[model samples]
Target: MFIISLTYKTSLENVERYIPGHNLFLQKYYDSGQFIASGRKEPRTGGIIIANAQSMNEAEQIISEDPFYIHQIAEYEITEFIPTKYNENFKIFIED
Candidate 1:
């Protein structure tokens, strides 16, 4: 699993301009089952994405495809983790 944190480097006006494109990017990954969940952070600073990429390389590649990354709208911080325990329904997103 990966916790993809995004911190805005630019103004909200700039971020809003790319949100539509960003939503499309997110939908593409969601359709591929790579993105588990994503949303804006409180105080509206940036956003977070819970992704199910198999490795750090894969995760980085995924991030590379984001409009935010391409436009340098935000800084990315990716943290990879092992899910020791999760809800039974969440097993579908977990890998052995």
Candidate 2:
């Protein structure tokens, strides 16, 4: 799993301009089962995405397609992790 953090590099006005398109991009990945969940961060400075991919390279490629990245509106930091423990409801997230 990958935890993708998006930190806004542009003004909120600029970010809002691309939100619609960004949402569409997110939906595409969601439909394909690449993205597990995503949403704005507290205080709305940026956003975060939980994604499932074969490798970091794959995750990066997926994030690169996001409108925020494509338009350079936000900077992304990706962290890959192995889930050692979680609620039973989250078991599917760790399973291959």
RMSD of each: 0.9, 0.8
Candidate 2 lDDT over residue span 1-96, tens digit each? 999999999999999999999999999999998888999999989999999888999998998888899999999999999889899998877887
Q: Compared with the true structure, what per-residue lDDT tens digits does model 1 show for residues 3-37?
A: 99999999999999999999999999999999999
Q: How does candidate 1 score on lDDT?
A: 0.95
Error of 1 at 10 (Å): 0.5
After superposing candidate 1 on the true structure, give the runs of residues whose Cα lies further than 4 Å from its correct spot.
Answer: none
Q: Count the backbone clashes (under 3 Å) in each candidate.
A: 0, 0
Per-residue error for 6 in candidate 1, Å, reads: 0.5
